[model samples]
Target: MYRLVVLAAAVALATAEVILTLHDCGSHDSIINSVRVEQCDSEPCIVHKGQDYTVHVNFTATRTVQEAHNVLHGGLGFISAPFPLQPENACQGSVTCPIVAGQTYEYVQTMTCPTFAPSITVTAKWEVKDENKQDIFCFNTRLQIKS
Candidate 1:
């Protein structure tokens, strides 16, 4: 009986570790998009004030959950505005495809900026949370917005 209990306890611990492994989703990948900044476009993209521009944040993630989701939340500090460039809208509007667990998903986030002029500084903080609102992982990226 003692041997059986020990064996069962070991199996349970192993199973728990597998279930709680670090699973991440988004632009930063050590083997893939590990560069300081995932650059999009030729840089110095031009746009007018009060207009929206799409900045693509490239990333990669190891899929651990059956369905993985990515979101982009950050601040855009321009010569004028120091807060977020857009309103507080969940980045769910940017991604659509489903990410498989244990797999690597290379993706790009197309974020909308409410208004930017001349040149602005863009900084993004991202978090991947499970369906239960548990944070699976986090990542940060920064870029210089030019127009």
Candidate 2:
């Protein structure tokens, strides 16, 4: 269905675009409150004292509901790398239909960071919404990668 596609696309975009800076959305602090590092291959990944290396970071986002709904199906995604989300598709700030209540959406993304510092943190953020831009839920997470 077209609605499903839009919802999927929104989530995909948030996942793909990794260049987003780690600044909270203006006046939307509550939208991205909790960010935890669920799992990681390694913590404080150590790199050579002065050498640089590449490490991959993975994270998740669990947003809260903004409005009462029977369900909240499709949600958007976010990334901290320079990668682009759904580069082939052309949708920005788009919306899909509302989902029933008590439903949670999950998304995953991978990014490359320099093992330059002792460690680096990556965070993801996104929202669940409907076709009219009504926000249902939002989420964010942080991953600590050591060098």
Best by lDDT: 1
Best by TM-score: 1
Q: Candidate 1: deviation at residue 46, Å?
A: 9.0
* Full-model lDDT for every candidate: 0.41, 0.32
Residue range 35-137, candidate 2, lDDT tens digits: 2222222332222333323222122223333332111111123424422233111122222122223343322222233344335455434333333354343
What TM-score does model 2 achieve against the real structure?
A: 0.26
Prediction 1 TM-score vs. true: 0.40
Flag regions of model 2 displaced more than 4 Å. 1-98, 101-119, 145-147
lDDT, residue 137, model 1: 47
lDDT of 1 by residue, 11-52 (tens): 775433111112234322222333222223323233334544
In model 1, the Cα lDDT at residue 147 comes to 41
Error of 2 at 13 (Å): 31
